[model samples]
Target: MTKSSGADPRKTDVKVSLIGGHRLAGATLHERTVTASLIGGADIDLTDVGIPDGAELRITKLSLIGGVSLRVPRNVRVDVRGLRLGGVKDDGPSEPGGPTVRIDAWGLVGGVSIRRA
Candidate 1:
């Protein structure tokens, strides 16, 4: 678990894994998170975090040959976009209005799954 922060530590850059797996929980996250992986995976649960109303929480995923499983809170909109050579699934909420989570992901060969928690 390697972490770096922006001007605000709440808005963080989380390196999930290099060749294994990592999990994120039990913390107060902010509006944005940047994550990456290579030949491994990451499980990110954002259900317990605080996202401002109508604000968009950006999750930028840079991964290759690995998987990223994301669990978001309820009543939020999830938008996933990227270029990938594998599967990307989003089983999140579809309600209109409220907080939004934008996932920008890019990978050569892997999978990304986003679900509600």
Candidate 2:
């Protein structure tokens, strides 16, 4: 959240939390975003955000013993992949034709939950 130094609520990156939780929501995100946590967790919400047609939004995650919960709008396609020792629960893509969101989640002893907003 430190990189979002404007009144537009646009976020390019988020600070990692070690022993607490971080919530990033209601912001216009960049094409690429990164989030990580050591012993905490993060909650990301992207609702009513506009993404260009055929554009791709990439989100990379790194978690050690934490988890991440992501909520996306219903008009985008989601592609999730990674290497993890935990688990991932994806609700799959929303619509057939829309913007693409690629998520790369790499973690150990944590989980990722993705669902519609």
- Please name the candidate that would achieve the greatest TM-score relative to the true structure: 2
* TM-score per candidate, chains pooled: 0.75, 0.76
Write model 2 residue lDDT over 65-107, tens digit each, in one string: 7677888888878787887776778786587888887878777
Off by over 4 Å in 1: 1-11, 26-28
Instruction: Find the 10 residues in a row with the least total lDDT in model 1.
Output: 1-10
Candidate 1 total steric clashes: 0
Clash count per candidate? 0, 0
lDDT of 1 by residue, 1-117 (tens): 223255555656566767766666626444566767776666778787666677777777777776678887777788878887767787754677887877777778767887887
> Every model's Cα RMSD, please?
3.9, 4.3
Global lDDT of each candidate? 0.70, 0.72
Clash pairs, candidate 2, are none
Query: Candidate 1, after superposition: displacement of residue 42 in Å?
Result: 2.1
